[model samples]
Target: MLWPTNYTKLASATMFTLFFAGATFAPKRMVNGENIQHFLQRHYCNAYKYLASRLRHLDAVIGFEVMNEPHNGFIGLKDLKAYHPTETLGPR
Candidate 1:
């Protein structure tokens, strides 16, 4: 199915927010009969595998790094409602 560019962008953004920003990946949290943490980890591993397979032949591509600047993912936060600022990289 073909999707409009704007729709695709919105969908991507929504998924990122839901999966990365919002997901706590707690063992108790269940989605579709699987633990959220395990589900996310499985998808991450699958994505890495797909990328590795596609880039394996490329000599220029030495390695792949996923989530280089990893966030805590809302874990062990004292305040759930408080806004925590992320450190900015690069110049303005």
Candidate 2:
């Protein structure tokens, strides 16, 4: 299963887009006073449930890096907010 460089990059980008595109349309509500940990736990639980059902055949995907260069700014916030408004840190 050796994919060519361009193919690998394209595949990765496509997968990222599909995964995040779903996230973009997810229900959103202001967690008025929720702590970050609590918010993340609740959000992750929902996400895991959905992924478990939708991607059940896939065994597991354990670790994750938030973004390539995640920082508070136009590009960073724009990218993160596009897929995860609830998860984005406020403007820098």
TM-scores of all candidate predictions against the true structure: 0.56, 0.27
Q: Tell me the whole-model lDDT of each prediction, alpha carbons only.
A: 0.52, 0.42
Residue 79, model 1: lDDT of 59
* Highest-scoring model, TM-score: 1
Error of 2 at 31 (Å): 3.4
In Å, residue 80's CA in model 1 sits off its true spot by: 2.7
Worst 10 residues of 2 by lDDT: 1-10
lDDT of 2: 0.42
Task: Tell me the alpha-carbon RMSD of every candidate.
Answer: 8.0, 12.6
